[model samples]
Target chain A: MVSRAGVDEIRAILDGVRDPEMPALSITDLGIVREIRQEDDTVVVALTPTYSGCPATRVIQDDVVRALHENGIESVRVEVRLAPAWSTDWLTPRGRERLREFGIAPPSGIVDGPVVVSVACPRCGSFATRERSHFGSTPCKALYRCDVCLEPFEYVKPH
Target chain B: MRDSARIEYVLRFGDGALVLAQRLCAWVAHAPVMEEDVAVANVSLDLFGQARMWLSYAGELEGAGRDEDRLAFHRDAREFHNVLLVERPNGDFADTTVRGYFYDLWASLALSELAGSHDERIAAIAQKSRKENAYHLRRSQDWIVRLGDGTQESHARVTRAVDELWRYTGELFIGDDVDAVAVGDGFGFAPEALREPWLERVRATFAQATLDVPPDTWMQRGGKQGVHTEDLGYLLAEMQVLPRSMPEAVW
Candidate 1:
């Protein structure tokens, strides 16, 4: 029987697996790892994609499996679940900080609300920013320009 | 009857997403700007994802071998149940944005109600989809405001788009026998229940955009019954061409 401590150890291993698109942060940091359980000899990892059609979802699943296998765990199953949806609120504080360090602004405000919140410039840490476009390098990010720094950056969308 | 109603309800959701996604894809490399191109594509992908989920669930409810791809690629025009608003052509940027704005608002409202569905799977899918739909609504709303309140030419174009597409919007909230049954089964809401909220939101957005709401006139129908405008056939011919021509080829 896999102990609770074993599950923690496996989670620790997964913490090292970075998101393919944003390598500065791990999948755990992104909050896509829904649950980690040990059922008999199998380590079952339940995941939720950041977006329904995110092309990176398949890659993230593969990465989780690979990361577990590399840690000497041969019996692993990754299940993708779509419930309660994925909100940017799931992003860890560490993840948000890492995004800023990588010149990207983290999501701001509520996911389901219609409020228009200003995204601060990640580079200059200035509040003078405007959205250049509603899409960026990936589906989950939007392009913005900092009036203060005059530098363009990506803002991780709140959803 | 219950099972068929469930399938029909699911098809309504699936067809709307799939058809709109296909229309959005037609804008690839043809958008007014690079950023707009990417934005449209991402929205298209989001809708495509939702379509796959709904269609996959529809297939399961049918208990047949049909899957998302089969339902999408194999179905003829008469078999589709998407409202006519989605299958309409992507006329100009204004037309696309106006059509998208109308549909996205309706979809978001419907999905919000669906999230509370008694059917666990439907609720799960709705909960997942509503977030994306919210973002799509925001994007479309933003574009409508931009175009509607922009230069004279832009304002004129958007106004024309609005008037042209207004008639089709009525079909969104009109319930049919399938919708009635789905509502009875606790898996869906009455389409008419969403009309007021949809109208309120649209009115507010149009007010902000300085665009006039076209006066109500004779409304189009029959798309929900697998009847469509002439555009759908041409759209499907292009969309299904690759898949049909190379049935044996694996992509």
Candidate 2:
């Protein structure tokens, strides 16, 4: 399946590969696509996991390869990188908007130390929200409830 | 430098993570509250991920054909090198919380040191795991304080859990030849060195919780040498059943 394609074209195709856990965001939008390059006849895509134990990692890898293959270029390698580890800071502006539109609060504020975020309600845009649970349905999310709107939602935890 | 010692040292940490991860998984649908169920499982998942990385590296260091899957699913209880602390049963909410609190306190420091390891791969794994472990440490600490200071019943239960679990804490910092080679060779943390700092935090947390630190007693040891309690035997039986029975089974 080893073939060749322009790096930019390959990147665009990758943007269509949605994260299985968060269907609203692409790998690129999540900033897990660290690099895309060609080496010897294989297109290498460097990926970093948002959480070390994220179950979506394997599915996301398969999706990346399948999406690239569907576009005609074949040989693809999904290299997992752990260093300079993935951060909430890497989430793109568009990804943040997409997360809010999907009723999930995106990570906000500084990432250097402890995350003391004041998460606004994605639905009512109210700041009267409180964390219900530090862990949610997924490893990267925390459950929150908007007091004003009385709606429970997921907040992308700042890591 | 003989790779054997390094491999064994790595297995000690990996096996602890794996065994503890398995123990936490047992709490999935059984935790008292829905939020706790999710919380425990999340921590379990993180440890599982760390176990995979550590075991995969150990396999590579072994220069064997085995990998993370082979090492994890195939090993018997006698072959595991985890300390005794992690294999303790999830007795109650207090028991589980105390067990995790002890480990998190030590892991936060051990991982911080490992993050600077000369072995780059080990360093990377530690660097990545430490960030996640920090949150775990905070949560467990909070639970300890809340339960210890909450009510007469809650305080009594948590105090009893602490007293029962305290003896297991000694094995974490006590080391042998495997540690010597790992630390002497500059690839591992000095286990003995972590005790004071670990205790300092433990004392501070206990003070806030209004719980007394248990007096030292004869410590239980030997899990690192592959001599585990009966609990590990049952744990491995359940964990390895699928892999041992259907080696070729795929999801």
Cα distance off (Å), candidate 1, residue B26: 1.4
lDDT of 2 by residue, A61-155 (tens): 99999998899877888999999888889999999999999999998685896657689999999989999988999988899999999999999
Proportion of native contacts present in model 1 = 0.75
Model 2: runs farther than 4 Å from truth? A1-5
Q: At residue A71, what lDDT does model 2 achieve?
A: 91
lDDT of 2 by residue, B137-214 (tens): 988999999999899988999999999999999999998988888788788888899999999999999999999999
The estimated TM-scores of all candidates read 0.94, 0.97
What is the Å distance of residue B220 in model 2 from its true position? Answer: 1.3
For candidate 1, lDDT tens digit of each residue in B1-251?
88988998889899999999999999999999999999999999998899988999999999899988889988999999999999989999999999999999999999999999999989999999888888789899999999988999999999999999999999998998998887888999999999999999989999999999877789999899999999999988888888788876675
Where's the lowest-lDDT run of ten residues in candidate 1 chain B? Answer: B242-251
Docking class of predicted structure 1 = medium
What's each prediction's clash count? 0, 1
- Which is the leading candidate under TM-score? 2
Docking class of 2: high
